[model samples]
Target: MTLNLFSQFASPYLLGVPLIFVASISPWLLLPSPANRWMPNRLIAIQTWFSKTFTKQIFSPIGPLGHKWALILTSLMAFLLTINLLGLLPYTFTPTTQLSMNLGMAIPFWLATVLIGFRNQPTASLGHFLPEGTPTPLIPILIIIETISLFIRPMALGVRLTANLTAGHLLIQLISTATLALLFSSPLVSSLTFITLLLLTILEIAVAMIQAYVFILLLSLYLQENT
Candidate 1:
């Protein structure tokens, strides 16, 4: 009973071994593969449309140089979108809810962009630390602050994803628990709570999609600065 209540967010395991990798990769297996024929099915058509639309949205504002990232960014969004929505299913675990997992994905991408900027435009990259014509004493302070903020990007990305999913899951568990507890005690309250849960579920679905987009969108913004 206790396990069922919180296992949705906990790292999954059979006996003692961790099943996080399995849970994390399960979402991708559900996606449909493209057919070999000329004409495509509805699902393929919809997937292609979404990929194109998302790629355009992310790359449209940025320069053409960064357009190459369309495949990577779009695939990332699809992966996150799948895992997040799948987590909402009964008895399922969400890997994105883990801060470690999110950071693992975020830091490398963020660092790669920073490295790209350094490699391509060293002077410009360093210029981001200390602005033009800064006061002597205040220069150090500003550099320190900017450096800290720059490093905070990955942490923020991981925390943002982790916190949103964690909060939503916890709330759903709490509300659902209250609903079940009240089922026999108070039918009126239980029914209303159930309806509220329904609404919250819908909201979480939207949140899952939006969070995935936001993650990719921010990465694209970072890539824009470098590319």
Candidate 2:
């Protein structure tokens, strides 16, 4: 029974092939393509506006050096946002919920920022591992601690997204299954459970959006540090 409850998190397979890629890429395919006309249609227009607005809000606080990443970061934000929201649908699987997939993204982006910092300003990068005016004895300890913290950032990013989405999905499944079970036995209780499920679904939607934003925002913050 416990294993059955967690079966949703398992990747769906057909004919011995995983459908994770299809699930991830389908959202992008559903997006509206731009027309050759001077003005885009309403869907495209809204997409453009949202992308521009998000890019501005995210990059406004970043330094000029970080501004160079605007396009890549913005696209990543959009991709994450789309996949997360789509995954909330009844039959869809969220690729972001997979820790392996999330880590794949987190590591490269975080490493890139670190590499950039090292290339452009090695002193500043290394300086992050040790603070100024450190006491002689604690200096080594502090440096080791800071270095560990630095390496932990990417794992934190990946685990945060994975854990949040996984927990939400589990709760939703639990409530939904309960609601179904109680329907015939107790309509009133089932109705209440159903209402709670609705509210939970709405909150999950917000969480899905926010988690994506937070992921990119943290990456941008990392970029800001290195830049």
lDDT of each: 0.90, 0.92
Q: In model 1, which runs have C-alpha deviations exceeding 4 angstroms?
A: 1-7, 15-17
Per residue, candidate 2 scores C-alpha lDDT tens digits across 1-227 of 78987788888988988989898888778777778899788999998899889989998888899999998998888889899998899887888889999999999999999999999889999999888889999999999999999999999999999999999999999999999999999999999999999999999999999999999999999998998
Candidate 2: worst 10 consecutive residues by lDDT?
A: 26-35
Residue lDDT tens for model 1, 100-133: 9999999999999999889988999999999999
